[model samples]
Target: MGEEMPLSRIAAAVGTPVYVYSQAALVERAAAYVQAAQQTAARCLVCFAVKANGNPALLRLLGEQGLGADLTSGGELFLAQFAGIPPHRLLFSGVGKTSAEIQQALQAGIRALHVESWAEMERIAGIAQTLQMAAPVAVRLNPDVAADTHPAIHTGGRQHKFGVNAQAARQMLLAAADHPWLSPVGLAAHIGSQIRELAPFRQATAALLRLAADLEAVGCRLQYLDVGGGLGLDSISQAAPRPAEWVAAVGEPVAQAGYELVLEPGRSLVGDAGILLTRVEYVKEEGGKWFVVVDAGMNDFLRPALYGGEHPIWPVALRSGRQRESRADHTWRVEVVGPVCESGDTLARDYELPPVAAGDLLAVMQAGAYGYAMSSNYNGRLRPPEVLISGAAYQIIRQRQTMTHLLG
Candidate 1:
C-alpha cells in the first residue's frame, strides 16, 4: 500500500513471485518499537529478531534506524555485522549452539549470548577460556507460560525444547557469576512467537523479576532482562497488541526493578511490511470445486503450508471490463493453491474472491517476516527475488536464483 508504482508494473518488471517490502513500513514499525521502549524503560535495547527476515538490504536499513540485532546463529551474526550492525549491538541466541558458533560470537565480542541450558553454558565457558575472552551471558528461563498461538512456533512452555526451567536457570546464572570466563550479564525468557495477549507476558515478566530478586539477594546483579518477542500480527477477527502495549507489558516491571529491557521482536516488526507478488497460471475446476493456481509454491513461501498461515490475497488489478463484484457471488469461492507437489501447499481454501482467470496478478499480504527466510530449494525450484520499495523508488535487493548458480 505504501508503494508508488502499481503492482502490475512491479510484477512486469521483476517477474512473478517476487517479494516486495515497503521501506516506509519497516521504518515506521521500528520507530514505534524504539519510541515505546524509550518511553517505558530507563534503559532498553529493541533488537530485531534476525530469524524473521535476514535480507541484507532490510537488515542494513533497520541497522541505520538505531535498532540492534537478535541473532540465532553464526550466519545471522555474520550478516548483521556485514550490514554494519556493530558487535555491541548484536546478541546471539539459540537453544543449540555449536562450539564454533560460540567461539565466533565470543571473538566478535557481541553484547551477549542467551544461554538456553547448562550444557550450553559450559560450552560457552570452554570456548571463552580457549579464546581468553569473557563471554557475556544471559540465561534463558522457561517460564512455562502458555501463549495463544500456533504450537509449531511455541517455545516457552516446559514441554517445549527451548529454555531451561527457573531452577536450572538460577543455578546456571550463579555458576556463571562464579566462573572466570563467563559473565552473567542478563536474565532472559521467551515464551513463544505470535503471542496475541498481554497476560502471558505479564506472567513471564513477574517470574523473571522474582528470579532476579533471588539472584540479587546473593549479590548477583543482572544488567538487563531479555523478554523474547512473539508479538503477533493482526488476524481476521482479533487485533494483535501494538508495539507500545507489548513494550509496556514487559518493560514496566523490569524498569521498576532497575534493570534494562531487551526485546527480540521478530514477526511483529516486519510481518506486515511485505507482500508476495505472484501471477495466476491457471484456473481449473475439479470435483465440483474451483481452484486458482499460482506460480509460487511451498519452496517459495512455506508459511501457508508449514504453519497453516492465512495470508490474504488480492488481485493486483481487476479486469478492465468487469465491474467490482460483491462478496455474495458464489462463483468466487475457490481454493488458491500453488504448484508444489504436496497437497499441503494450498495457500487458502474456500477463499472468496472475484472471478480470476489465468494471467491475473495477485499479491499475498503480510509475508514480510517468515516468507523468504524459511524458503528452500525444494523440488529444485529457484527462489524468487526480493525488492525493497521506498516511496516512488524501488530496488531489487536480492536477485532471483539462476539455474547456473543453483547447479554450480
Candidate 2:
C-alpha cells in the first residue's frame, strides 16, 4: 500500500492529486492470472489491456511479469513496443481502428488483430496485401450475451457497436480464406466490463465454442479463442474473483474446446492496485449541505463523473494512534467534489467521511483502471502525476502536466 510508503512523503515530493500504484500489488495481481491459467487445462496468454492504464512503467512492469499487451489503437501499439512487449505478445483490438492503425499493426507483425467487424477485416486484408504480409486475424464475435453491468460498458450484445454476430464472423472467416494476406487464426469475444457475475461469460463462451465447432466442421479450425476480459472488481467491498476462480469459470470451456486461451484483463488486475491521492482544498457549506472540494478534478480521475462509478475516499495522514477511533467518531456526511467548473464534476455524492479539513489528503481507492486513463484536460485543469510505490520507496512514473502543456 502507498500508505506504507507514507503517501504524504510522495505528495510532498511530487505534489497532490497524483496516482500512486504499488509495484507489489501490480506483480501480485498479474501473477494471480498466470497462476490461474497454469492450473487450467489449456495454455493461457494474459494480455494486459492498454486502454485501462497505458502508463509505460505499468506496461513494462506487466510485460516483465510475462504478460502481453492488448492494444486498441496505433498509439497503444507504439506504447506496447516502447514498454518492451514483444511483437508476438501484442494483440490489436477495438472497433474503430483506422486504416492507418491497421496498417501499422500489420507492419509491426503483432501476434494477432482481433477484428471487430467484417468491414475492418476487409481493410486489414487490403492493407496486408499492400504490405505483402500475412495478417494474423481473430474475428470478435458478438454473442448477444448481455451482461447486467452498466449499459455503457457492455460490448457483447447485438446492439453494441463492438463485435460482429456469430454468423457474420463465420462468413468473414470464410471470406478471409480467399484473401491471401489474411490468416484467420483465432476467435474473440468481449461481453462487457465490471461484470460481477459469471453467467454472462459462461453464456458467451458457450456461444463461441459452438461457433468454433461449426468452424471446425467447415475446415476452419481456430488455433486460439480470446475470451475478452470483463472480470469485475468491487470498489466498495474490495472484492473480486480470485484468479483461479476466474480461470476455472471462464477458461475451462475454452480449454475443453482445444483452443489456446487469450484474456484481455484491464480492470480486474489493476483496479484495486492503485489509488488517486488528492488534497482537500476547501470544506464549505452551502444550502445546508457540506462540500469537500479537493485539488483533483475530473481532469485527474474521470470515472466518478463519467461512469457514475464510486471509489472509496480515505483521509491520508491519519492522526497517530487514533486512526480507527478517529474514523469511527467523524461521521459527517459530505459531497466530494472537484474545482472543475461543471455541475457534473462531482466525485462522490452522499458519502460519509471523517472530519476532513483543508490541507488534509484524500486517497480515492480502487481507481487503478479507468481513473487516469480516461482523464482529460477539460476546464484547463492539468492532469496529475503518477507515482509507483514499492515498499518504503517510491518514484514518480509520470510527471504532472505543466501549464504550457495546455498551450501545446
Candidate 3:
C-alpha cells in the first residue's frame, strides 16, 4: 500500500476492523482510466461510480485527478457536490429513482440524467417542465448483452429490471427529443459489474452505436455514448483487460462516430487500493472443521455473504522464526468466520492460512470498492473507520461509528 506506517501499527491505533486505502493506488488507477479514455476519445469523461466507495475523501481525491462522478441517488449527488466536483462533470444514473430525486437532480443541473425507463423519462420531463428547465437526458439502453459475471449483478440482460430494451429506448429518446422540457443528449448502457471479458462490452457498444446512428439519421444527435463501466478488478482475474485495452475496445467506434465517451468505473478504480484489517478473536476446531473467527463481521464487510466474494486474507505479521514459504506447508484448511451471529457471516471458506493466534492481525485484500460501501449495522455492530495512506503519513478519513450512530 506504499505506507511507511505498518499495518499492525495502524490497526493498533484505529482498532481492528478498519479500512485502509492507498492514495497512490487510487491516483494511479484514476490516471490510467483518464489517460486511456483521453487517448481513445478526443472528448471523454471518466466518472467514478460513486456507489462503489462514496467516501468524500476518496471522491475528492478522484475529482482532483480530473474524474467526474456517476451517481445513483440524491444522496450521492449531494456527496459529489460536497466533494467539489462541478455539476457539468456529474452524471445521475440509476433505476427506480424517486420523483424527489429527479427534481433534485434537475435542480442541481447535472450534465445529464441517465434515464432508465419511459416512465422515468416522463417523470423527469414533467418535473423539468414544472421547473421550467430543459432536463438534459440520456436513455439507458439495455442492450440485452449477457456479461460473464455473477447473475446477481447482471443488469443488461433482458430479464433484468434495468434499462429499457433497444426498441423501447429508441422510441423513448425520439419522444423525448420532441418533448418540451426533455433534451435528449446521450445514450447509456451498463451491462453489469465485474465484467472480465471485452466481448460483452464490444457487443453492448455495437448495439448502442447502431441506435445512435439510427437516431442521427432522424436528425436526433447525441453528445456522448456512455458505456457504463464494469471493468473487473485484477483480484478477480489477472487476465482482465487493462484500462487502455478496455477503452480501445469500446471507445474506438464511438470516437470514430464523433461522440464523447463517458465511462462509469466503480470497482476497478478502488478495489485493489484498500484493504480491511481485522484481529483474530479465536481459532478453534470442531466437527473436523477449522474456523478462524475474526473481529470483523458480515456487518463490516458483506461482499462475502452477499456475493460470495473471496478476498485473500494474510497475516499482518508472522510469528517468531516463521518463514513465508515454509508457513504454507504448516497451514491448515480453515473457514474464516466473523463475530456476527449468522452462518452466512463466513468470509472465506475452505481457505488455507498459516498458524495464527487469537491476537494475530489479518488483512482482507481487494476490499476498497464494495467492502465498506455495502456494510450495515445488522448485528448492532458499529461500522469501522476508514484510513487513507499517503506516502509515510496517514489520516482517518472516516471515524468509526459509535453506539449513538447505530441508535440514530
**Tens-digit lDDT string for candidate 3 (263-369):** 99999889999999999998888898989999999999998898787788988975566344523667878899999999999989998888887888999998999
TM-scores for the candidates: 0.97, 0.96, 0.97
C-alpha root-mean-square deviation, each candidate: 1.8, 2.5, 2.0
* Tens digits of per-residue lDDT for model 2, 1-408: 643698888888999889999999999999988878767855779999999999999999999999998899899999999999999889998889999998888888899999987788888888888888999999999999878777889988889898898899999988777678888889989898888788898898889899999989989988888888998887564466665677788799899878898889999999889999999898888998889999989888888787788789988875444343323665788899999998778989989997777888999998899878988899988888888988888888999899999997
* Candidate 1 structure lDDT: 0.90
Task: Please list the C-alpha lDDT of all candidates, in the order they appear.
Answer: 0.90, 0.87, 0.91
Q: Please, what are the lDDT tens digits per residue for candidate 1 over residues 57-164?
A: 999989988899999999999999999998888898889999999988999999999999888998999989988999999999999998888899888898998889
Order of the predicted models by lDDT, top scorer first: 3, 1, 2
Give the Cα error of residue 309 in candidate 3, in Å. Answer: 1.2
Better model by TM-score: candidate 1 vs candidate 2: 1
Which candidate achieves the best lDDT against the true structure?
3
Q: How well does candidate 1 score on lDDT at residue 18?
A: 94
The lDDT of model 3 is 0.91
Between candidates 2 and 3, name the one with more favorable TM-score.
3
Give candidate 1's root-mean-square deviation (CA, Å): 1.8
